[model samples]
Target: MPTSILRIDASSRSCGSFSRDIGDVVERSLLAKHPGADITRRDLAQQQIEHIRNETIIGYYTPGEAMTDELKAVTLTSDEIIAEAKSADILLITTPMYNFSIPSALKAWIDQLVRIGRTFDYDGHSFTGLLPGKQAYVVIAYGAGGYSDDGPLAGADFAKPYLSFLLGFLGIQDVTFVPVEATTADPATVACEVEKARQNVRSSLDAG
Candidate 1:
């Protein structure tokens, strides 16, 4: 069981977000299993994160102790963001399909976590991840396309493929996808997707 959870919400909508609903279910299930689990929430809709600035990049490249005061200020936000993720045992990333991709805010958050020198190490020939031993659940909400492994638009999904790649790049191989798709279709179709997601969540928790 995860002793700490980092819940990152990328949905633009706050009230009726399907991804957030799925995250809520997952968080509740986890809480049931690990009763005092600590939850750290980063709601992108509420938190404003800018894209990686040139100054921040320079600051991040410089050693933290050696960086100047100006550079330290530039990289402080991203530093804090990385620290949060580094402390978590599980990450629940709920992202809605924004133009067939993630929201800009979520992208910014990812940029912060994928910093050089902090989350990875280059051994000349290749790189090794510094953040491992954690699991991730990606809950993607879509209006029409069903992008699961067996869905008709299976190979058409760029979100899941990209997210999986990002996780692997960070040495996070134990990842699960909970897709809630075809929301603009009939009620039956949406319900079917929700049921499938619920089942997947249960199975994931059980297997873990």
Candidate 2:
């Protein structure tokens, strides 16, 4: 069977977005490895996933046999989102840092995916993620420099750490990051950063 890849784009910009361009590099590299891979692209900016609501929360706790039609209608989006995630072998997420963390749309999507009795389970004491044996490649674009681990402003980078933890919570332990930093720098520097991100994608895919 062919590999299944879920590509999620969280960048608000429709064109000339660093994160999207880097994502293209990742998609191409993956295709080179798995020519007939099934690719599912979800553009959060265009689709605009709604934030979870009270009805959705109620649906989560309600047992399947006890769920009402109203609750089911409200929770259908979450069900679809979780189904897509469950069907993927690899996840490719591309997002530019927004206020030192992930975009609101991406966060909303995460909230929908991390549900009890679906993606994860808690046995009164311990928690186990239902979705395992999957890998993730996250491409993060930063407007300014110094957010890398060795950079001076590394302490302020909440995006990377948050994503790392979130993916692990969902049982995706094999996660790689491709950083595109200093995008607000001069034209030459921006080009260099983009090229570096491309090379990083290639190298990570090669290693994988």
Candidate 3:
């Protein structure tokens, strides 16, 4: 079946971002795999949403409550972001590691979409995810060094694990990570790793 794919980019360094370059390849791979798939690209670097405020939060939670014109205008964008995520069959994220974490823009987007009773709900005992049957693919690029989820540095980091946890909480346990590491290792080595990542993406698509 044809799918609706949402491609999100969270790299700040426009043309020079390795993650963006890799993300393009991933998008191309997706298109080749599913010729009928529709793609929606959201570049966090370019079109970033401001951090939600207290008023925006109030507006988001107030179902039928009247809001000031300004509040309504701010909340509308958040509503659209939520709608896009909910409607997508899959989400592909391309992000560069900033100080060993996710970019602020990406975090801001999450804040908007992760509304109570929207993306998730608290049952009697625990919170249950409302979004299901969706898959996600994450591509992470590092400028220096590398860290694994089980590595010592991973515990101190909020980028990778936080993203995984939030998405998993949203019923997307089938998330996959394709990390392009060792950027500071050597220029040649970084190029090789990037190629390897692209090849892996191609192979995955081909298998599908």
TM-score of each predicted structure versus truth:
0.94, 0.97, 0.90
TM-score for candidate 1, please give it: 0.94
- List CA RMSD, all candidates: 1.7, 1.0, 2.1
Candidate 3 colliding pairs: none
Candidate 3 C-alpha error for residue 11, in Å: 0.4
Better of 1 and 3 by TM-score: 1
Model 1 per-residue lDDT tens digits across residues 44-106: 999878888889889878976799999988888888999998999998899987777788888
RMSD of 2: 1.0
Q: lDDT scores for all predictions?
A: 0.86, 0.93, 0.83
Q: Output the worst ten-in-a-row residue range by lDDT, candidate 3.
A: 145-154
> Model 3 — TM-score against the truth?
0.90
Cα lDDT over the full model 3: 0.83
Worst 10 residues of 1 by lDDT: 145-154
Error of 2 at 154 (Å): 0.6
Off by over 4 Å in 3: 65-70, 149-157
